[model samples]
Target: MTLHRLILREIRHRKVNFALSVLGAAVAVAAVLSTVGALRAYDRETEAVIDEMEEATKAEMAKLEDEIRKSMKGLGFNLFIFPEGQDLSEVYAEGFASRTMPEEYVTKLAESGVVTVNHLLPSLTKKLEWPEQKRTVILIGVRGEVPIAHRSPKAPLIDPVEPGHLVMGYELHRSLGLKKGDTVTFMEREFTIDDTYEARGSKDDITLWMNLGECQEMLDMKGEINAIQALECNCATVDRLGEIRAELGEILPNTQIIETQSTALARAEARNQAAATSRAQIEAKEEQRARLRAEREKLAGWLLPVATLVSMIWIGLLAFINVRERLPEIGILRAIGVKGRTILGAFLGRAVLAGVVGGVIGVVVAKVVKLPSVDSGPIIESGEWIAAIVTAPLLAALAAWLPSLAAAQRDPAEVLRHD
Candidate 1:
């Protein structure tokens, strides 16, 4: 009979051993594919989770930034820029600058492309006696906020005082018995009451606002401004004042910058807290993903090898039993002049057949079954399928190697005598 026929007859004669060997191979292949598929599925899940987290982080950052912007707007201008050599103590006591600088200095800063400060308002302020009201009040002059060349324009925190009009403080208007549209004479100039402010417990309550050109002309200090009020940006650096000074020094070399720490510090702290919260959330998510990945890896690290080892040992044991049971047949065949190589081929062929059939069934089952750990579904690559299929037969061949060798090298004379 042919080697193929011999292998077929041997499988038919001992169907139980052949079926057990095939089952072992099937379980091994299925286990390996399941493990690999689970890992791939987990990797895909992680990537999707990270992508979603990134989008959420961006949205959260945008919302926080909007909140900060609104908070800073409410805080108002926190930086005051005055001409160099002007005493801050005098400014504090008198509520206005004693010295003056060119009005064009503010325009120069606006055009300088400085990003650290914004909302540039140039004003000429003085403490003068109101002749008509017979009250001593501070006079302030403002035109409007200057727009930066490189940045988007923002709404002015303080509105501009129109020409020939006056925005009176609460104390000046209330004490003087004046209301909107009422005429007031100051420094011999007639100004209609354009707006009246509510009571503010500050120097602003005792102040009078007028047009810049009109105030400069009235004070006989034309084309001059004493102070430039601006809002400083809350950035990542702690040395904000120093940075602003350096930038201003480069643009307006003869100007001095003063910060209102109460407002600036509040804005900075709010921004810092928001940033910290964002970082903490992202870090926590990353740590969680890493922990899950480590757990999966730990489980896979031992499970695959143990399954493969058990399958190999089971196949090896089954081959040994088959060899012992077929010894008489092998001895008779040897007496009939069958070669050792034919016997070895017959045993090895049965193992290869079992491996091929089991590998096909395992691959199909792995594709259909879903792992409990995987949420989406089974994930298997073409390369993994090829590896499993190709490795199954090789594994079976290796497991049967020792048993097949012993069968091929058996002493026919001793085997027959023992039978």
Candidate 2:
């Protein structure tokens, strides 16, 4: 007989058995699809959290650094006070004091085109005499680079202060109940509020700003500054700062130079530690997700086999009935000289066909139950879709094959004698 004729005859004779096996395979395929879907969802959730935290952390650090720079400048501006011989409460317009170098010293330094030997003044602690508290708030002196804000146009009260105007820390403003354009007395000198701005660090919160000259005069410390900060100029500027330090030491040397590199290094190390911790947390999270995924895969390994095993038992029972019912026909065919192996082949073929049909149906069922697309980031990366499709059908085929083989080997002559 032709292969088509054989196939038709085989399926027609065993239609019931074929139908049952198809049902079993279809169910097996559906189970496999569900397992793969769960894993993908977890993958996406972990990645999204990591990205947001990284961005926020960096922004916070930058904000802190910027705030520190502003506090320094504000302190520097406040240090603008009067000369040593000059009296306090005389100089006003918030400015710096220059040290009195001899005329020839200035001339020679100017000739070097490097050392500009002008009179550099020192600033002292500003004192805020609070009458109610009966205690003076000793204002900490900051270096140059303070952030100042002004009043808003509509409000003229809450605007961001511009440079050259003094701004107070937010808390300091609150404590004194001071607003924009209010004057606060410190070091016996009356400095205008000019404007009020929010605080960035500890110093700005408690300190008042004025010209360094005014600060020197008010504090009664003149022609000297606490520290000389360097601008990143050539080697000459660096060298000059060092030389000027010695000259100033001879003149009135009691100040110290703070090495910014150490501070910067410490800051960078802190940032590195933070980043490392973040990375560690992320790794731990990812590892946890990986562990969960591994568990899921293990569960799938058990479930696929278990589902196929249970499904195959049903198929085996169906195969047994089909074999029993057709035994008389099978015995007659054998007596009429048909081959035994051929009978076995025919039965096996029918089961295989049924299993394939069941697998296809199961796959169709899975396709019908589409997972709703989640908009969560990174949840559905590439390659996962490929895994889902390939695993489903193979599992279904296995479910049907093992049971049908057992049924195919039954003795037809013995079965024919059954009632």
Local accuracy by lDDT, each model:
0.83, 0.50
Residue-level error in angstroms, candidate 2, position 392: 8.5
Estimate the TM-score of every prediction: 0.65, 0.56
Candidate 2 residue-wise lDDT at 290? 79
Candidate No. with top lDDT: 1
**Regions more than 4 Å wrong, model 2:** 1-17, 36-164, 169-176, 181-206, 210-256, 259-262, 335-337, 365-419
lDDT of 1 by residue, 1-419 (tens): 58998888878888999999999888899888988887788788877877787778788877776776655643445677889999999987876789999999998999999988877889999888888767788888999788888998776666788999999989988888999999988878888999998887777888889999999999999999999987777654548767876888789889888775456677667767876877777778878877987888898789899989999899999988989999998898888888998888888888888888778777887787788867866688988888888888789878888898889888899899999
Winning model by TM-score: 1
10 residues in a row with least lDDT, candidate 1? 68-77
Candidate 2: tens digits of C-alpha lDDT, residues 1-419:
75346757867766666676677766765565544544455455546655666676677656654554343333442122223453223222222223321222222222343332222222344446645435545443333321111211121112333323455666667877989888765434455677565766645565555555445554555543433332221122345445544443343322222223333334445556666776787678778767876877798789977886777776666666666667676766666666766666656666666666765676656545644432332232234434434443344334434443443454556656662
